[model samples]
Target: MPGFPAAGPPGGPQRSSAETYAQVQASPEFAALRRRWRGFIFPVSALFLIWFLAYVLLSAYAPGIVNTRVGGSNITVGLLFGLLQFVSTFAIATIYSRFAEKELDPEASRLRAEVEDSL
Candidate 1:
């Protein structure tokens, strides 16, 4: 509530929901928003899945590499990699948050306001 924009007026023109939605869907702005979402989501999802799959495969089929000690430390390669998974997850979340804030939210807010004002 503190950070988000205030809502528009409650009452608006009495139009069919389908008509409003169709109008919005037909807008180029909506198309660009969808494209931006997919552009970020698809590649990030693919990369994370690949990384996870590699970790799983390594753990199952190549224990020697996964279990190897790092330097004189007690930490194993598997442990490091496992820890890195969490780090990467947080990093990606931060990146996405920044990206959405910078590139997506403003456009989405504009679209939302436009729809609300029309409604």
Candidate 2:
């Protein structure tokens, strides 16, 4: 025990996982990152779910509406709505990517650097 390192390479004390987690959690940058993440995800998820449910409910209960033809083409309201699901998925993904790149990534990187420096 007198000659050996306690638990690490012996340059300094290694930080425990809990310590690192606590440090990150206490950081204002980390808190802001989490807030941005949840703020974007929750509202967008709720909106998408609501839109999807509306499409489903309307298709089931009001076929006359969704079945209506579009502009003399073979497409119908149902077709457009179905396509919109894919469109909305891509749109949300794009929006989130942009949001993360612009709003989240910088703070996240700063937090990461701080944690690494502390370690």
Candidate 3:
């Protein structure tokens, strides 16, 4: 246990970790951070899910369209859609990384420091 990280502040009469986190969670800054997170995440997630489901449904119920050759090239509509899935995944990751770095990280760092300082 000597080298192991602490589970939390040493158990005592001092305030519980939950109370501290609850304080942070109740803060307006935390609320805004959460809003920003949910705003970006929920819509993007829904859109991506819709895009993926459309592809799957098309492949299942509309093979002719999915299998159609694009511009006389060997690439089929299904192949293009499949490739777009990978593209969209990478795009989303990149966007999230940028958003977190630009917007979330600074606020989160400040919040963490506040908690640590309070401890």
Candidate 4:
């Protein structure tokens, strides 16, 4: 145990090893998940933040864009957004796929194996 590296804090990312391990002990799956998915989470969060803010801004100040009609059958501008919403979700899934298969899954799997081996 002396040679094994410690973990960090739970709830969120922290600078200390104790904090990280506290997190690992609390959620064994997340310990490895955090390592693999951390990279994806940050940028994804930022993108979501920007996306949310854009949606808020559009809904608030850009009502015209939200209500613009596309077809004679009374297509609202927001209806177009439903399509974008699906696109965005799919895009995020795609991004996660690349990250998971390429980096996160492998690292997490390796760490998980290491942890299991220790047990």
Best by TM-score: 1
Top of the candidates by lDDT: 3
For candidate 3, give the lDDT: 0.85
Please state the error at residue 12 of candidate 1 in Å.
12
Error of 3 at 67 (Å): 0.8
What is the full ranking by lDDT, best candidate first?
3, 1, 2, 4
The C-alpha stretches of model 2 lying farther than 4 A from their native spots are 1-12
Q: What is the per-residue lDDT of model 4 for residues 27-113, given as tens digits with 9 covering 90 to 100?
A: 656665675577678889798768767876887899999888887658777777766767888888898888789877675666555
Provide TM-scores for the models.
0.86, 0.84, 0.85, 0.60
Tens digit of per-residue lDDT, candidate 3, span 48-74: 999999999999999999999999999
What does the lDDT read for residue 70 in candidate 3? 99
Question: Which TM-score value belongs to model 1?
Answer: 0.86
Stretches of model 1 off by over 4 angstroms after superposition: 1-13
lDDT per residue as tens, model 2, 1-119? 22111335558677675677686787666777899899999999999999999999999999999999999989999999999999999999999999999999987777766666555
**Backbone clashes counted, model 2:** 0
lDDT of 1 at 78: 96
Candidate closer to the true structure by TM-score (higher is better), 3 or 4? 3
**Lowest summed-lDDT stretch of 10 residues in model 2?**
1-10
For model 1, give the RMSD to the true fold: 6.0
